[model samples]
Target: MLPVKPFRQRTGYCGPASLKMVLDYFGIRKTEKELAVLSGATKKQGVQDGEGLVKAARSLGLKAALKDKATLADIRKYIKQEIPVIVNWFSVNEGHYSVVVDIDKENLYIKDPEWGYTRAMRLDTFMEVWFSIRGNVPSSKEDFNIRRLIAVEPHKPRRGRAKKK
Candidate 1:
């Protein structure tokens, strides 16, 4: 499992808090206030979507991508690569952002910013929560689609050639 630090979200600062945890895991230090501005966070709305977090990561010299319709396998793949993924979860019309730190046979370990802790959710239960967005009902696992996924990674040098001294 990756060593990710959790920070409790301040009001609507879940997006920034989640991003801070992921960046901290990569050894990059950034304040939630800085991320809030880069992520377009507002006092009332916080962040509307993962795009803002993607932008914040990119602004920090990291590579970030925003994806929709993400799957459980996609999350697992990122976890296997030791990369933390930020996902938007919706519950009863309220949306929140959290980081996915590890995955096991039956549970997905999440670094939730709201609670500032690691929570284990069953694989099936995780999917069910994703489907809970907008009251969407999925007929099968294949039909599960997440609202947004922000994948961030530090920039890696090209492997084909070395830089001149």
Candidate 2:
């Protein structure tokens, strides 16, 4: 595991979907409880960067640097930043881009640009079965957000069972 060093450290929140801003944060993916579970650190890494895909891509990297300006922008364009597991572009079609991000039992901060707001996805419900577990995205690209795309999946019932119709 890459030593628990944050990719960047900024002064405050940057607002909206900007990778550069997100990277400056420390705890973007793991919530306090989750961090306690994962790193056993007294402090947590929750609510760091852009969440989901960004976090996953970052952690999986052999080097694990916060997505740089170009990289972040590139990713925002193609991959859904909701789950860190979405390490790259091709996985966009697998419908398996699920990963925990800024989770807090009731809230799950995602980063798909389209997935405006949703929370607590019950990650245990879908662990490593995600799409980009192997982590295979080349370093980000220029004019990344220019493409404007979306990642879709069969909606899993938010509460428990989909109400039996």
Candidate 3:
């Protein structure tokens, strides 16, 4: 199970919060404030794009990649490998991000930072909401198109050297 961290109320911090969870899964400890700075998030605007997520993860020596128009199969493959994927989507007509931690035959398990817990949604409904955020036009609010995915690849820890005799 992925560690879930809820974004502070009234804070536009879903990106950093989601990133924190993924980092935590990899045993990387970082506070939300540190993650916010690493992700280039601001109070005036949340994570502007997936670039912030990719850069932040890479800064920590992790291989992070952003995939556009990602499919359900793609997410499942990552989860099967124990790599958590952050999905960008629109909820209530507003841009939102969540971590895809697990999946079943009919449902996708999401660790929603905004909601402060794990929520289950049918795969079809999840895809619809995920794909709905699309377009090139920019507005005051966050606008995104073609489902975006930030995959945090697993990194095997290197063993430390033993003391010399």
Which number leads on lDDT? 1
**Which residue segments of model 1 deviate by more than 4 Å?**
131-147, 157-165
Model 3: pairs clashing at backbone N, Cα or C within 3 Å: 134-145
TM-score, one value per model: 0.83, 0.24, 0.82
lDDT of each: 0.79, 0.27, 0.75
Write the candidate numbers in order of decreasing TM-score. 1, 3, 2
Leading candidate by TM-score: 1
Q: What lDDT, from 0 to 1, does candidate 1 have?
A: 0.79
lDDT minimum window of 10 residues, candidate 2: 1-10
Q: Give the poorly placed runs of model 2, Cα more than 4 Å off.
A: 1-92, 95-101, 105-108, 133-165
lDDT of 3: 0.75
Question: Number of clashes in every candidate structure?
Answer: 0, 17, 1
Predictions ranked by lDDT, top down?
1, 3, 2
RMSD of each: 6.3, 16.2, 5.5
Task: Give a tens-digit lDDT track for model 2, residues 9-89.
Answer: 121111122222122122333332332222222222222222343333234232233332233333333223332312221
Cα deviation of 56 in candidate 2 (Å)? 15
TM-score result, candidate 2: 0.24
Model 3 residue 48 CA deviation (Å) reads 1.2
Error of 2 at 60 (Å): 20
